[model samples]
Target: MKATEVLADAYERIAEVVHDAVEGLSAEELNARIDPKANSITWLVWHLTRVQDDHVAEASGLERVWTAQDWFTRFALPLPAAATGYGHTPRQVGTVLVESGELLLGYFDAVHEQSTGFIRGLTATDLERVVDAGWDPPVTLGVRLVSVLADDLQHAGQAAFVRGALQRR
Candidate 1:
């Protein structure tokens, strides 16, 4: 399969994992922190989605679904519009609470859809284009996309583990 198609499939699988992680969990369960320093399921889901939205939008030169669709307003988070949960302290992680699993899933779904669309429109040449210059070796679109996918998958797994912990509790 082509590079874009591979990315689309990977993203779709990540979306499924994310959905399952939060599925049927209450806000209380999602917001539950097993340890004082651990990130909550709500925060994990939100952060993962936010990172995907931010990175993909930057690569695509499109507005993030968060601001484009006013998800920040819906979330009513205390942080600024630019917060993507990177480098969040324990205190900052605790602040990410949602009313319900549906709300988190809604944002995830929207962001995933936008990301999938962007991936679908990408060609081999587009994937080969350099998108970041901070690193010694500038990042390519494909590398950036893979990085986002890896982060999202890790967070989604963490969320699922949190859900399982809550269930056993």
Candidate 2:
């Protein structure tokens, strides 16, 4: 398989996991926190989607799906347009309130489409191109894509765990 195909598959798995985590969850459940300091399922999913949208857009030199698609306004979140839930405090996490799973899922689906499109268009040479220079080893497109996959998958798993915990309660 092509390298980009592999990456696209990984991203597709994230979308599946996210769907599993949020499916059938009530708005209250999505916003419920197992612990006051822990992130709610809603927050986790939203954060992961935002992070993916931000990183992939940057790597692809395209506008973030969040902004390009007006997801921030659709979400009507309390934060600024650029907020991605990274470094969000417990209080900040609590601010991610959505009325329905569809809202989160809709945004995620849009982002996943955009992410896969960017990945699909990438060439082997494109993957080798540097996207960020802040690190000791400059971050290449491939490295950044892997980083995003790792981060999104971690959050998706966390959301699944939270859903299980909520189910048990």
Candidate 3:
């Protein structure tokens, strides 16, 4: 199979998990942390989406949906406009509020659409191109995408786990 197809499929799986984790959850459930220091479903989904938006945008030279579509304004989060939840402390995680599950899904769907669109156009050569030079072996477009996918999948699963745990409690 082509690299583009593989990339697109990977994104699709992540979206499924993300949707399952957030769909039908009330605002309280989305925002509720399993413990005082744990991340909420809201935080996990938001962080994963933000990371995907930021990384994929950088790799594709496209604008992030967060700023391009003014989702930052919509969220009206207390933190800075650039906050993507990386290194967010427990206190900061508590601040990722949403009124409903739909808001979370809306943002995730926007990001997923943008991301898949970009990936569908990539050639193998494009994936081979270096996107970052700070790392020891540097980072290629392929590596960067895989990294993002791994992170997103892990967080999506965490969100799903949080949802199940919340329901159990």
Say which prediction, candidate 1 or candidate 2, comes out ahead on lDDT: 1
After superposition, the stretches of candidate 3 with alpha carbons farther than 4 Å from their true spots are none
lDDT tens digits by residue: candidate 1, 12-99 = 9999999999989878888999999999999999999999999999989999999999999999999999999999999999999999
Model 2, 1-169: lDDT tens digits are 9998999999999999999999998999999999999999999999999999999888887899898888889999989999999899989999999999999999999999989988998888999999999998999999999999999999999999999999999
TM-score of each model, paired residue for residue: 0.98, 0.98, 0.98
Local lDDT at 109 for model 3: 98
- Cα error of candidate 1 at position 85, Å: 0.6
Given candidate 3, what's the lDDT at residue 47?
Answer: 95
- In candidate 1, stretches whose alpha carbon ends up further than 4 angstroms from where it belongs are none
Clashing pairs in 1: none
Q: RMSD to native for every prediction?
A: 0.7, 0.7, 0.6
Estimate every model's Cα lDDT from 0 to 1.
0.95, 0.94, 0.94
- lDDT (0-100) at residue 115 of candidate 1? 96
Global local distance difference test of model 2: 0.94
lDDT of 1 at 145: 99
Model 1 lDDT, residue 83, Cα: 100
